[model samples]
Target chain A: MGGDVIDFYFDFASPYAYLAAGRVDGLSQRVGRPVRWRPILLGAVFKISGGQPNLNKPLQGDYLRLDVPRCARLWEIPLHQPLPSPFPSLAASRAFYWLDQVGGEHSPAALARAVFQAHWAEGRDMALPENVLDVAASLGLERDAVEAGIAQSQVKDRLRAETEAAIARGVFGAPFFFIGHEPFWGADRMDQMEDWLQRGGW
Target chain B: MGGDVIDFYFDFASPYAYLAAGRVDGLSQRVGRPVRWRPILLGAVFKISGGQPNLNKPLQGDYLRLDVPRCARLWEIPLHQPLPSPFPSLAASRAFYWLDQVGGEHSPAALARAVFQAHWAEGRDMALPENVLDVAASLGLERDAVEAGIAQSQVKDRLRAETEAAIARGVFGAPFFFIGHEPFWGADRMDQMEDWLQRGGW
Candidate 1:
């Protein structure tokens, strides 16, 4: 990453993350910051935060089932409408911290994009190891390096550590970003984030 | 209203309208369009469209109370935040259309901006005659002409007709704009509406 960097710590289990992956880099670049992609498991983060899935909230399940895709269509983004959308993000999310450790300065952005596309776009099985490797190889990266990263105990620890770091930073959810200690906790603030960055995060 | 105009039909009662009002003009300038300000009653549009207010539903009331202002702050706009939002809006709705009749010819934009500021910015009582007059004065418009226009049966009839026309155009809510029937609802789309003026609403 070049310029003033704002680390965009994210997870593949989120549709918001998919949208952010496409726009975050461009947003940062336009606003004169190079956004650093930091992939971390939200499951671990949730465990720490004690946050409940929004769909499980009363009446929200219907909104997610019906309203969310309507909102996506209005914004002109493609949607698969994940069947079990509060996705079991463990394997795919762990894969990222895993890749970062062993993949030797890997293209975090590319890998993040591939897995986001896998879960949100292709609607593939995230729990499957074959699917994870398929996502890596498709990105023209070595698959064994990713698999090797996952098998290591340190990778698991790093993911946990990163999640704990996010919680300590006061991040309440996935797609959380920061400017110094200012926590903006939604995907909707993307433009404002760019505006703040353009002003050198003043 | 110049160029290939996109009339942003909107209501002050709607929170989304406030968000759109604050930024749509600037956004349109960025997107290269002239956002025509078309003030209309969302309640009337809902009446015609059979659309239910989300507030009537239990869970949505909380979401509205929370999420709407979050969008306002996220977008950096002012909000009134009146509890129960004063259910009946007919008088204010009529007044906007009435003002448009007097101020409609060339400077509808000024008149529309004042109304948005009054309702969303200052949280003034829109039903008060003095408040509306002050809004007119702030726009550097003659208060007498606005007062005179309010007494006209034609203006009132025309406002009712405008509501009917909005319904005919499939407008389901306030701050809904049609870029040649490509509905961009909310005052926030005003920039999009403005751009339609530049790009030809097709």
Candidate 2:
């Protein structure tokens, strides 16, 4: 994941993650750089940090609900919350790592976009294993193999190792990016990140 | 506080607050609008929200420590962490509201800048009452009156009420701004806020 690549870490269930997902690739293409899509489980990171998701908070929850749509409108992206939002993202993460092994390098990025759209743009449930396989199949990945891949021990271990590595690297939130050791947090920092990429950091 | 005025909320003890304090006025001037500088105590708001300062968090603390200086350099602002960082901001907040009463419309803004500079730029300990009085004296205010002003029950009550009002308005963090009730959180959202002001909100 080194050598002029943007290590983009995100969780499928995060609305802000989806927002960044929509832009990270285009930004990469514009800069003539490749983006390595690293999907991490925010729940496990939150457990270690003793923090809770914004959807569970009181005043923050309402403001975030409003802000997400505002951001979508401003960025000109389609966004709609799923029926059971704040849902488990493990199935989506497991599918991603499985694709990373069987499918080509670009497959994970394509599948990540579809999964994010399924949960964030189309308002489809991502917690179900069936929904995850449908997203992979649409990307032209085999259906039965993708289904079997989710339950494989190697896929589970890969996701676990990636999340732990993220925690060890001090990544406590979603949509976190590493531009060659300089960490940029939050979707709001996208402009700053682009400036850094173009200007070669300050 | 209404009618095309941007309500800018901040705490003197917050480094991120200092960053926004430096930019909000310039953005307002460029957009041909006014800003009401509302100094708030984040500790009180944290008490209600079950949140703590970033300095206490594990990963967040380290990332913030790096991000603050990076932001400062990028903005080309002079910044130096004061001795006894995270110093008490009561004296500064009380001085602000008192000046808001006795002084003219621009007096509070001038004093807020001085207090922020004293703590964040000049590396002075704002926790000391003397340091706060010195800041007020530099602004041509009566020193003895400013000294006594910090101890007044009414001044303390004003800061408390403003903080509670901020919480009621869904302000959960420092450097929060409102372009006529459209809430924007974080100093990074400064660009979006300016765009909203220029385009008359999306």
TM-score of each: 0.56, 0.93
Q: What lDDT score goes with residue B186 in model 1?
A: 50
Fraction of true inter-chain Cα contacts (below 8 Å) kept per model? 0.04, 0.44
lDDT of 1 by residue, B88-171 (tens): 444455556676554444366666667767776667867676677788777776778777766678867776787788787767
TM-score of chain B of each: 0.78, 0.94
Worst 10 residues of 1 chain A by lDDT: A59-68
Candidate 2 docking DockQ: 0.57
> Could you list the iRMS of every candidate?
8.8, 1.7
Model 2 CA RMSD to the hidden true structure, in angstroms = 2.4
Q: Over the stretch A2-49, how does candidate 1's per-residue lDDT look in tens digits?
A: 345676877766666666676676677676666667776776766765
Highest DockQ model number:
2
